[model samples]
Target: MTKKTQTPAVQKGNTDPNTLQLHKDPAQTDAAQIAAMALGSVAANAMTARSFAKGTFGTLDVTECVMTLKQRVDTTHGGDLKHAETTLTAQAATLDAIFNEMARRAALNMGEYLDATERYMRLALKAQGQCRATLETLAAIKNPPIVFARQANIAHGPQQINNEAISGTTTTRARKTRTRQNELLEEPQHGSTQLDDRTTPASARGHTAVEAVEPIHRTTKRRRESSGGA
Candidate 1:
């Protein structure tokens, strides 16, 4: 007959429920209880560490717990955003109720006691402000404000704004030149007179048509005086 080998069973210790042993796996029941509790990270981790020693977590590790919490937060955030309008509207309504209650209490306490009345009025104002803020938030979420960029004329690829400017300047200079020419035309010419009785050279030469020549005199004042005296 062959000899049979027997293995020793795992040992269990009795320690304080609030204290953690340096080398022991946490009770499965404790892990389950902490996991089911709706506690924050700090409290949860403290309780979980105290419950689970030997750096052993049953069914879930610290990383797994963190990931589970993160997933839950993500889910909650998505749900909240999905129902943001309804949630904000409900919150606004609640604030309105609170405002009304505070106002009613203020009205009742008016003139009887200054402190109580002031406190109630202050609370009522605070509630009214909160309600307004909630409604504004809801409105913003529903119809977000559109940011309209200022209308701009953006030029691309080395656009020359000065091209048009130069053309405009040229046009202005041309106009000025035309104006000067017109002024010169309107002004009387020096030492020149119109002779209505003058006839064309062709008429004078018994021809049908031809050019006429007019003499221009360049006389000084002394010569004019001598001529006038003569």
Candidate 2:
């Protein structure tokens, strides 16, 4: 019986619950989480402000016009409204300042979060790529016992054992040579050359026109009057 080399999951060490290994790099992830949480806190505070948590005045209640025609009357709704309006206006300005501050803080926190997120995203992507490369290498060498031992002792240092990349320069050169040979030996076969119908052309133009047709099938459930059952 042939033994299976290594399962992809096993090779990648995906048994761990954490998508990323926390022990490998905890500080960075923690910093990223903190930034994200700070942004959330700022947003929550902004929401509370909108919910009138501090009772910021939305509108000032002003009387349209309650004019008294009585001469020497001790009552005055006009004065009361004027006083209320003046007080509310100043309060509204103060509320505006508070709202603006909340918005500023929220924006500032969000900016930090965005910056942190961008940084971590880049890091995560790089790590993910590295993990993928490692898994691929692991998978490629799982069957090869010699390579398995070589990869087992893999470590970062000045003496990095790299596989020399054989570039496609030779392949390109061969292709160019083949192209030149084809040019020298071959003639334009499509323009002037004629091909028999039975012998299909080496370079034939494909038919593009689609034949239009009327619908041929019809569905019927009724019996004809002349052919009706007696």
Candidate 3:
């Protein structure tokens, strides 16, 4: 029998969960957790919006309007929500940097801290502005006036009018072509010099005589060819 090798046991460390570790700060950790939670919530909401767009919510009550708005958001501002989420995540990393710097120094300069905080705050405000813009766009999508304006623009555009005219002309030409083809198919094919009632002999039943005759010009040409051959 072959001898089996035993795996080494993992070592455990005596570290305090609540206390800040070397090169790590508890404040930044807390900030990171908060940011993660916030981002998770936003992601969850976006998923819910997507479900609403799919008509998961029954077509009853005020949910129908909500569903419509959700669909419009998905169509028009698809990237907005993701961009906002990304901005928040980046800001969270910035927060971690800020807090790490604070942890490194025994005493931080108030002026510098204030400046960094202000800059971060501006970024946060910009993210908030983006969120607000997305909401405003959703509102516009839901607005009847805006919807009607879009419809009217589509209906009365010069290109649309030209397309309609071209379609009509094409349809008319197709119909005329079909009618001509049908007439050609229905008409009898016969040589020229059709026999008239006076020239044709009457039938035994006293019916007006109708006979297929070779064209006079063709008969004459055939006779000339035969004479030349002879």
The candidate that wins on lDDT is 1
lDDT of 1 by residue, 104-164 (tens): 9999989888799999999999999999999999889878897744443558887534434
Error of 1 at 142 (Å): 1.6
Model 2 root-mean-square deviation: 41.5
lDDT of 3 by residue, 77-178 (tens): 654455444445566556555555544442343357777666556555655555566555544544525222222224644544323323667898999998
User: Which one wins by lDDT: 2 or 3?
Assistant: 3
Task: Give one digit per residue, the lDDT tens place, for model 2 in 50-90.
Answer: 44523665521111011111211222333334433444455
Candidate 3 is scored at a TM of 0.18
Off by over 4 Å in 2: 1-80, 114-230
* TM-scores, each model vs. reference: 0.38, 0.17, 0.18
**Candidate 1 vs candidate 2: which has greater TM-score?**
1
Q: What lDDT does the true structure give each of the candidates?
A: 0.67, 0.47, 0.51
**How do all the candidates rank in terms of TM-score, highest first?**
1, 3, 2
User: Which pairs clash in model 3?
Assistant: none
